[model samples]
Target chain A: MEDLDKELVRRARLGDKDAFAAIYEHNLPRIYRFIYFKTANRATAEEITQEVFLAALRAIPRYHDEGFLVSSWLYEIARNKVIDFYRSKKSDISIDEELEERPELTSTDFVKTMETKIEADKLKNLLKKLPEDYQNIILLRFVEDLSNEEVAHSLGKSLGAVRVLQHRALKALRKLVE
Target chain B: MTKERIHNLFDKAKEIKPSEGFLSRTRARLYEEPLDHPRSQFFFESLHFGATQAGIYATAACAAAFIIYMSSSISVNEKQSVAMKRTEQIEDYKIDVTLKDARYYKEVAPNVFVVVSK
Candidate 1:
């Protein structure tokens, strides 16, 4: 995967639109899922996800391999875009407002379906309520399925530190889950 | 807590994949718009190689200039020091014999000579 990413990055650096497209296809889902979970809104997630990819595309010509995965660089951009989104909006409550504005509740669904959606919503809210560090650890580790080493690189933490953080994050998440 | 349970909770949590046309929409937006590269990345990409080549040429030229300057200055200094040493030698010279007893007098410099007795 690393070699493949290197190849794609090399091609992209040479102004290969096809290679840039491949990179977009490769990283889109993970970036979108990350933004979705972070913002808890599809529209905002889509917007920021697009912005992140566009940012990556523009930045690709200068991409130098720094002995880490190319995805690490993209993840760094995605994380920053999320941060920037919140900063420019000047309110974290906008996410909750987005949650309230979603049309999921107005659907004419059965009680069981509504209950399941409510449970999912509750889980999302709980996940969001965890401290930012723990939230990022959980999402990157379990949701994104990144390996511990990758998580360490993505989060700029040591491997042992990521392990300890993941352990604590899971414990806290478990308490919230229960 | 069991890793399985944690995994299950993560799996059960809201898995909000982007809408169906999300990738296409993103691709269209990406293709339609001209991407504005960050200033730093732009400067690095556009200028680095050219700048490096220019730097190499500049350094080589400077080194050549320095060598030329040092060699010319050193030659001048060497010529001056040689003339000074010659003058000192002339001043330090002493004759132990008079001109009447001298057998051979060889003129080696203007108005100056070394006498040798046979």
Candidate 2:
């Protein structure tokens, strides 16, 4: 899978639109979920996810292979885009606060939507109270099942730092849970 | 909640995804948009290449000028030395002729030799 992604990245770097599209398709869900957790808004997540892919497409030529998955790179972009999103909004409202303020929707598709929403809300409320780095480590390491190296790359930290952060984050989350 | 419960919650959260319509729409829009090639990168690369080439040419020019200056200066010095040697030889010839004339006059005509010496 890493080889395939590397091949796709190599081709995409050469302006292969199809290769880029493939990369977009493969990474879209993870990036979307990442943004979704950050923003806690479906529309905003979708918007940021689109922006992340566009940014990635433009910057594909500059991306060098550093023995990490492309998803790690996408995660980094998604993380920055989320930061930019919050900065532009200039709202001090946190994700948990945003989740609380979110209106309950009623629809014929309520069952599935509510199930997904409740799960996202529960996860967010639990993870959101932690420090930003802790939340990122938890989400990327556990929720996204990214390797420690990939998490390290995504968070711009050393593997040892990621391990420490993961341990601390889990301990913090455990306290919150208890 | 144990770590197991937290993991379970995260697993459920993974079910959250963008709608199919949103996915398709985004893909279409991304494809419609042209990929951006940062002009700044191109400008810098061109500047760097131009500077390197200019440096190579300047070095070559300086080496050629040094070679030409050294060769020309050596030839000029050789010409000056040859001219100085020729002048010295002419002076020696004049001295030899005066000595010979002085000797002949001293032997053949002492009075004429006095005038000649004067």
Tell me the whole-model lDDT of each prediction, alpha carbons only: 0.72, 0.80
Which tens-of-lDDT digit does each residue in A69-149 have in candidate 2? 899999999999998998898443433332233334345456676776787788887877888899898888877899998
> What is the per-residue lDDT of model 1 for residues A42-131, given as tens digits with 9 covering 90 to 100?
667788899999888888877878877777788889888988998888444343333343435434433544454455565568778788
Q: At residue A30, what lDDT does model 2 achieve?
A: 87
Considering every candidate listed, which one attains the maximal lDDT? 2
Cα displacement (Å) at residue A106, model 1: 17
Please identify model 2 stretches exceeding 4 Å from their true place.
A90-109, B37-118
Q: List the residue pairs that clash in candidate 2.
A: none
Q: Identify the candidate with maximal TM-score.
A: 2
Residue-level lDDT tens digits of model 2 in B84-108: 6755654455433366666764554
